[model samples]
Every structure is written in C-alpha cells, then in structure tokens.
Target: MIPISVVVVVLGGWSVLYLADTILKSFNSLKNSYENWLALHGLSIAPFHLRWQTSFFNRVFYKFTERSFKEIFQKFSVGMVFGVIAMFGSMILLAKTLMQTLAQMMEEAPSVQSDHVLQVVSSSSRIFTSRSILLSLKHTQVVVPGINLPVSQLAYFFLAILISGVIHEIGHGVAAIREQVRFNGFGMFIFVVYPGAFVDLLTTHLQLISPVQQLRIFCAG
Candidate 1:
C-alpha cells in the first residue's frame, strides 16, 4: 500500500491546481467598476482582476461599530492601544517558540539517512512541531510534489489563513473609512500557490492623513 504521506501529497497538489483554475475562471465575470479600478492602477492581470461585491459582513461592521467608518478613527482610538499590545505579545511568543525550535533542532543527533533524506526529515519535523509561522515557512512541505501534508491538516491550515486574513483586512478597511480615506475595494491575492486577502486604500488620501491617524490605520490590522 502507498504511504499516507504520498496520498496526501497527491491530493494536495490536485486540490491546489483545481482552486487556482476555479479562481481564474471566476475573474472573467468581474463587474465593470472593479475592472475600471484595476485598470486605473495598471494592474490589469488576466484571471486576477478585482471582483467587488456588497458584503453584509462589512455593512455590519460599519453599522454597529462606527456608523459607516466615517467615525472609524474615533471608534478605534482606544482599540489601537489594544492592537499594539496584541501585536507585541504575538511577536514575543513567535520569537520564543522559534528559538526553542531552533535549539531543539541543534540538539538533535545526525540522522542515519543520506544527506538529502536527512534534510527533508529535519524540515518536516520542525514544521510539524512549531505553531508560530503557520504553513508559509521555508521548512513547510505543504503544496510541493515531494512534500506531504495530511488532508485534514491542510483543510485546517487554509481555514485558519482565511479567517485570519478576513479579520486583518476588516481592521484596516473600517479604520480607513472612519478616517475619511477612500476605500477602493477588497480582493484576493494569489501569491504563487498561496492565497491571501487585502484592502485597497487610496495612497494619496492615506498620505494626507495625520501621522497619528496613519499609524492608527496601520495598527488596526
């Protein structure tokens, strides 16, 4: 029987290809507003155009949180302090975990396997043990043909990224609107095989804002 690792690698490769194809196909149907916006920015990449929509999720944020983001600066005044605290705490945890992982890897004895085999084994061990960086780390063997990641773990990994990305973008979006900064729209970014999200802001308007206001907008994310 084939090893479970081999099966996972095969399935992960197929699913990623399928997802990329699906997203590319969907981009062909984007509305004219989004198309115009992309054109204005000289970012008219085929199969990766902006696709705008009226989302209730954001509507709720502006509605309950700060009355359409015009009040975002005031609403998030105290929240910025909390956001900074959270960011520092996260950084500290990441540093500690990474240091510990490195120390452990250094303490590990040399493997009986060949050099190539030993390198792969060591990378896989570190990825499985550390929770700090998620799946984007150099050591992770998620989507590559020779790398193996179980289907269940892959699903969880993608879900975590999606949730985190949405929350992050919302923080920036609402804050931008509250500061009276223009929000172009939100969109997905397909960086190689990895998927991510972002909020579009008018760079000129953003630069015109006060330094403290600009810092708050950035820290919201």
Candidate 2:
C-alpha cells in the first residue's frame, strides 16, 4: 500500500507545476513577449525543457584566455592529461564495482532460494521479507521517489546537477576560446528531471585548430 504522505507529496508537486504552467499559458501577451525575448537571446523552450542561450559570457572567456600563449598551452595541456587519466580511472572503478556487486548477488542467490522454501513453510514472515528485499533492490537499481530518494531531496539533487553542468560548460568555453576557436554562445537546459549545460563553438574554427588544442577543448569539460 502506498503511504498517504507519499500520495500527498506527489499530488502537491504536480498541482504546483500545473498551476505554474497554466498561469504562464493563460497570459497570452506575457507569454508572447517572453517567447520573443528568449528568441532574441537565441533561446528556445518546449514541454519539459527550456534552453537559454547568450553570448554575454564571451567577454569573460576572452579575459581569462588573454595570457602568454605558452602559459595558456601549458595549463590546458595539464588539464587535458589529467582529464584523460580521470576518465580511464573512473571506467576502471565502475567496472570493478560492478564485478563486485555481481559476485555478491551470486553469493546471495542461495539465501534467496532458502527464503522461497521458507515462504512455502512460514508464508507470512518469509514472503514479507522477500518482498521487502525485492523492493529494495528495485529501488537501488532505479531512482524512485519515496523509495530510493525522498521527494524533498529532489530539489537539492537537481540544483547540484545544474551547478556542475554550468561549471563544466564554462571550462569548455574557456578552453575553446583559448585555442582560438570561436565561442558562439553558452546555453543551459532542463530536460525533464535532468539539468545540463552546453557551449556552442564554430565547427570550422575547431577543425582549423591543431589536434593538441582540440584535445584540450574536448577534455575541458
């Protein structure tokens, strides 16, 4: 049975979101004006997502990049190397963790079988225990509100993701600008529950740059 608190929280959240969307759509002139403003800034919006873009950060990128060529190259070169190392390290760690978890599950398989037999003998206790374990495993494998994570913590999770994304894109933008690549714009978006940021650069400019400079730009994020 679903908890009453969980039901209330879900309904409240949906109601708030619906009300906000309705208010925005109900004001025709306001909605049109907002859309026009977003368009002017190279932004766009769709259901469950909003993209805001602007070239206002170009000056900051340029300022950061304005340094001796050798110094800039050395800094980004170090970043590129460390980024490669971290990428491989993370892959290895993830693989190792997955192997360990699989081994542990295998070891627990007999216990699960035992539980099944016990369920047939003492139906109530064993059935409840097995169900609880299955539910916990399900929630562990997937993010489920009120199961894996509380509804109240969702806001902080999203906020942290947004901040990390913004910083990541900023790094790419700065690195591209330093490599003499054209920094077209920066943008952010929220797609459903996930938040992300991106930097736009001229493809032609990227193609013209040396491979080392390209590596720096790619690894900066």
lDDT of 2 by residue, 143-172 (tens): 554566776787787798889999888888
Compared with the true structure, what per-residue lDDT tens digits does model 1 show for residues 1-221? Answer: 33577567756765775565556546866556555765565343423232333333555555644654445555577777887788899886776566555444544645443344445546877644433333224352224322455444655666677679878888888788777787766666554334567887889999999987887888877
Q: Whose lDDT is greatest here?
A: 2
What are the C-alpha RMSDs, in order, of all predicted structures? 9.8, 8.6
lDDT scores in order: 0.62, 0.73
Query: What pairs collide in candidate 2?
Result: none
- Kindly report which residue stretches of model 1 are placed more than 4 angstroms away from their true locations once superposed: 1-75, 110-149
TM-score of model number 1: 0.54
